[model samples]
Target: MSHSQPDTISAALARGRLGISSVVSFVIAAAAPLTVVAGGATTGYAVTGVTGIPLAYLVVAVVLALFAVGYVAMSRRIINAGAFYTYVSRGLGRPAGAGAAMVALLAYNAMQIGLYGGAGAVLAQFLDGYGVDAPWWVWALVAWAVVAVLGVLRIDLNGRVLAVVLIAECVVALVFDAVMVSHPADGGVSFDTLAPSHVFAAGIGAALVTAITGFVGFEGTVVFSEETRDPRRTIAWATYIALAVTGLLYGFSAWAMSVATGPDRIVEAARADGTDLIFTLVSPHLTDSVITVARVLFITSLFAALLSFHHTVARYLFALGRERVLPPAFGRTSRRTGAPKIGSLVQSGLAAAVLIAYALAEADPIVHLFFWVTVTGGLGVLILMTLTSVAVVGFFARIVHAEGLWRSTIAPNVAAVALGGILAITLGEFDTLLGVAPDSPLRWAFPASYGVAGLLGIVWALILRATRPHVYDAIGLGADRDTTALRTPDLVRHPA
Candidate 1:
């Protein structure tokens, strides 16, 4: 319990620095409501020719809510910034946890770096209007610089930045939705896209996977648990609040787009306007200045997501370092800011390297970099969620706990099955998600990368077991004091 213990002082994040609102802001910013509505939803309609995106978001939200029942229940017992990695380690085994850790790093890095392609493209297009012509990578590097700086500063300061941007983004989205809904096509609103029949029709698999991508960052709630004020309550409230706000925003905005353009024409409009579909729908009703503001908010939305994911990836590294799974250097936090300095720098470096490589290759920033990479990241997360659900059942079954059967067992079992099904569908439609021919190697390559990463992690974990059993045993134990306390029966106990 001593605050000055070398181990605790070395590995601890800034304790009790975040409250519910701050945590919720981080989660929502990562979801990037404006970016998703403007880019993801439109892309889903255009690419899949599916009009049921609104219903898809609602269904994914419900599935995630089921997943959270056990997720938050486990968070109450195990506090770690490693989140999925830590949970899998404790609930499953050290080897699985190690594999989960590698997969998480790959997934989050892909998500974070992919945004630069998006932010860069969006910003470059926005600037072209003002006669400021530049390559997309130039703007991407600008965003990368800003996020790198923010990544090493105080965590709460980053939260404040996200909160400001998220509020404006949500307000603009709702206003746009209202304008679109009020001026429905042919003076009549259509509820066709919201119907179950449309949602369950052919191509529904791709639509559901696209919707799941929009909800990617909500699982990040427990990632900040160790640093939150009253984590047990704050984590749960933030998780649900994030899911509700994002679900409603995405579904409403998508449906409004359908209402603005008749459901029949929604696919055509998305194909024509691409990411600008939402802006184009409202532009005829609003002034040029207001449209400009909305466009700028769209760019900021991408930046906010970059910063949020940067923090998540850095913390995962910090957790791994603290457990000696990687190197102890990763565990060290800045004395002044309590930030994961080494980990943050490492993530920034990786992002910069990827951006440069893509620029050198002359890849299309939006298509090859943004859409393809981020969707692949979403797939990795989907796999992790499925595994974590099974881990929850395993963890609770072995330990003594006060949770009911529903929270401890039933919900997780249901979630595992649900997520596993979605994972299968997503894999089956991976080529569709990437807009590639079914026989293209890119489809298999991206998903296969995670498999390789997971296998490498397992091999490393087994090596650690044989050579460094002490480090292996301490796998998911989190920070220094928590590790000591958790080893005792009073903190967490197993059946005799």
Candidate 2:
């Protein structure tokens, strides 16, 4: 009875209650299939034309798979909530990890807060359709409130909510794909869409960049590793599964959409119809009621994405806090649900501030708030992933593990180079991606913010090293522990 008491107390404080399925749901929710289809696919068509969009997804998938080979290997050794920050630290050093952590905090928060602009815009439109008109920011605040509530609850509860939304999203997409496939437009189902030469005919670089952005949230599998049932196996399996599912689903849907609209006309249709192109094609077959259902599902999909990202940002804060890199208050979890209560509240505060500022400035939600911020966030993630791949190679090169040559060295290097090239192209064509002028400061400003954040992170680490050596020792290596030693006031904060 005495031994069991400690176990119960530990369980209540450190909540690692998530499993493989729950982890998968969190990642998929972050990807937000409906948003990808509605936004990414439409943009891909407008930028690269039809034949190349599917191919772009396939290529990015292969590169990320190579990246994951080393990523999963490191996850087994260093289990922490910091994700890229932890992996980079394991491979590089604590300062570099701290830099990555700053990047991650900025990237994840940018991504999450950016989604509010989209959710508000979409929800406002959905409400408008039902004769309930309101300002976009008002709708955004509604979602903010709901997500804030969910973020403070148990993670398993969030998982269940995401699972239901994810299922509805998948169902609607599959049904749409089936309808499109069964009634392929004039040219009929053509394998021509899958041809490499055809896929790159319009523009290879643009298509590849857009496609990679669609897979943004897959790397987040490791963020939940501490909460998962089995960190090593769960992280590895979830990473692979999330990547495969996202790539296949995205590739298949783009192809079906092209076929539904006729390959030759897809670009024109996308340019003309935007996100409504696919809905228009499928609307002819499905009942009128299905349209309303899909629109509702679309709103829920954005909400799920918001909640998933909120949890991700909160966890990052929680991990950093536990290391004394940030305030230790963020490290506190609820005894009842094991949720990072303080971290969740912190994230919510940030989101509210951003939303309020944007509203005050009267910024255009879609253009200024959503696309501008999300595109920046996506670029930051790419940079982090590229660095992580390099870190992986560096880590495995020294450490003698049984994982073999391919997993340790070769794959990581190749992924890093490929990703580096993509990053260069993305920068070169920044104006085109942002739909802005060649000299737009917004183009340079967003990417520059990341560099500033990284420099700040490095400085902060050096300060910690000089002032508090003990706290500096545990930067990216922070994880929950029961030991009384090292449990300083600056370190782990236990639940009361």
Measured by TM-score, the strongest candidate is 1
Per lDDT, the best of the predicted structures is: 1
Which regions of candidate 1 are displaced past 4 Å?
1-9, 480-483, 489-496
Worst 10 residues of 2 by lDDT: 487-496
**Model 1 Cα shift for residue 90 (angstroms):** 1.3
Candidate 2 local lDDT, 175-247, one digit each (tens):
8888888898884697556677954353566577777777888999998988888899999999999999888
How far residue 170's Cα lies from its native spot in candidate 2, in Å, is 1.2
Q: Model 1 misses residue 280 by how many Å?
A: 0.6
Candidate 1 lDDT, 229-335, residue by residue in tens: 89999999999999999999999999999999999999999999989999999999999999999999999999999999999999999999988999987988877
Error of 1 at 382 (Å): 0.7
